[model samples]
Target: MTSIFDADGKQVPCTVIEAGPCVVTQVKTLEKDGYTAVQLAYDEKKEKKTTAALAGHFKKAGTTPKRRLVEFRYFEEDKQQGETLTVELFNEGDFIDVVGTSKGKGFQGVVKRHNFSGVGGQTHGQHNRLRAPGSLGASSFPSRVFKGMRMAGRTGGDRVKIQNLRVVKVYPEQNVLVVSGSVPGAKGSYVIIEK
Candidate 1:
């Protein structure tokens, strides 16, 4: 492996990975389980919030209560028994897709959110109607406005997928994964990236 270094030959690009000592909360098999995937839970919290049933589920796996749990399409070849997956799972220059929730921009106009040309007028006495949608309803046919119309409603704060972001570096010791482009959500949001 080539040494990941910065301009001064210091390792800068290496991302800090906060991988667990995660617990195998649940295991899926082909027979009764009907699938082959392991549910891993990271960032454990107190037992109070977790129910006795769910707590016992984690207990059976030899792990404590966790805040978040996710299941992936697990294959036998990619399986590593009792080992944790960290930032070291990725190498430099690997292309990955990042998925996260985008920042919420509440009740945005068409021009801002949907990029519609709003009632085009800088000429004839344009007053306040600049950002308005011209005609929401057609006069004769289709009396009521169609459903799923792109009107001024809740914008952003949705699941966003950014494709082909180059993995610049991965610092397994620090537990961070830094990609080439911007990610969704705020500064400290959980994002899942896959190959």
Candidate 2:
């Protein structure tokens, strides 16, 4: 998705996602289901990898198989049994949301992880401490360091949502989606594109 822009007002290259052969597993309406939405099932799974109930659900949809299931909000449609949704529902220049898991960067320091500027340059006998985070807890006045400060622990590998991404291209034939920006996770990771 586009990031913070300069004074000139331009958008960055947002990531594209070829969303689905997303099968309509269920639909929700305001009166009966009390919401407007559709549930989509995607990603083929081995029979061994799926449970019996999920297998039955996909079988009823007449879909090959699926490993992940996702739902869209406030999107309404009358889909027949075994009906499938595809990337063709979107076109070029469409703004959409891309959802995926970010890459995991295990444990890191505040300087590398949170981009905090650590101390100063090593000169005039500054010793070995350069990037070490200094002063976490206050000196007696506050008694303790506040919880949930930007200290580094496990970073990334999070469910990240990039919104307003422009759809660059779609290859429904190969189930390939090319968006404008970098997506989370590796190439094989499954991503969700919502319009």
Candidate 3:
């Protein structure tokens, strides 16, 4: 994330994103595929590493194999097959939602995972029960721990959606987009921006 100076000399926090030179690999219509959508391909990949079926698909599109292919249902862009999309699709002040996988924090405890209060005071000769999760469940009533219990486990590395972020700037020459505030994923991870 970085800060940019707006026209009024106000500093705005924003996240820089490489907003695609995506190719329209396929266009699906209602009569043919039972829906209207466009499959866009991004990031180049070696042909030798691509599967035979995918190679044929890329050949049909008259483009090289790509690393990512995402389908946007009911896209209203009026784009045709084998066309390219860039940062020009968005403008400053446009609101969008960003979707990406968050950074992985690995295994975590209840105190860090669920904002649990560490077993209160340490007066009654308690040695190391400060961060314990107190109880599992009712002992005699249910006889088992309840489902969906908030306990210590994995943290982060989840698909996170950050909504309604304004487009602060667009550098179409460099295929970069600067959106207001921070976004999910690591520095080089790919993210989807939806209007």
Candidate 4:
């Protein structure tokens, strides 16, 4: 994440994303694959780390092995296999949706996960019950703690889609895009951008 100065001299917060020079690995057709979509590959990877089957797949595309492969449905343009896509696909002031995995906060309690107030005021022999999740349910009727109850459990590390982020800048030469607001995932993690 970084800050950029706009025309009015106001500092705007944004996230710089590598918009790719992604290779088109495959093109699915309605008759052949029962769907229409374009599969794109990004980021270079070592042959030693790539499986033989995947290596052959990349070889068919006339490109080296890529670390990430994503399929985009409903692509408007006519793109063939082995074609490269860059930041020129987007323009300044355009709104796009970014999808990525959020950071993992393993084993979080209700106080942080569900934003519970933590049993209210800490009084009346409430020593360590401040951050505890109050109660489950009735002890007898429908005993089994009812499904879909919000409680302490694993949190984060989920696929999150942030919609309608404006494109602040586009550097086609470097295949980079600067979008307004924060993006999910840690640094260097791959994100899928959709218009």
Best by lDDT: 4
Best candidate, TM-score: 4
- For candidate 4, write residues 1-195 as lDDT tens digits: 999999999999999999889999999999999999999999999999999999999999999999999999999899999999999999899999999999999999999999998877877877888889888878887778878999999999999999999999999889999999999999998899999
Estimate every model's Cα lDDT from 0 to 1: 0.71, 0.75, 0.92, 0.95
**Each model's TM-score?**
0.82, 0.81, 0.96, 0.96
Number of the candidate with higher lDDT, 1 or 2: 2
Task: TM-score winner between 3 and 4, please give it.
Answer: 4
> Which stretches in model 4 have alpha-carbon errors above 4 Å?
none
The TM-score obtained by model 4 is: 0.96
Tell me the lDDT of model 4 at 64.
99
RMSD per model, one decimal:
4.3, 4.9, 1.1, 1.0
TM-score of 2: 0.81
If ranked by lDDT, best first, what sequence of candidates would result? 4, 3, 2, 1
lDDT of 1: 0.71
Query: Ranking under TM-score, best-scoring first?
Result: 4, 3, 1, 2
lDDT of 1 by residue, 128-169 (tens): 888887788776787788898778888999999988977777
TM value for model 3: 0.96
* Clashing residue pairs for model 1: 15-170, 15-171, 15-176, 16-174, 16-175, 16-176, 17-175, 17-176, 18-175
lDDT of 4: 0.95
Each prediction's number of clashing residue pairs: 9, 7, 0, 0
CA lDDT, candidate 3, residue 8? 98
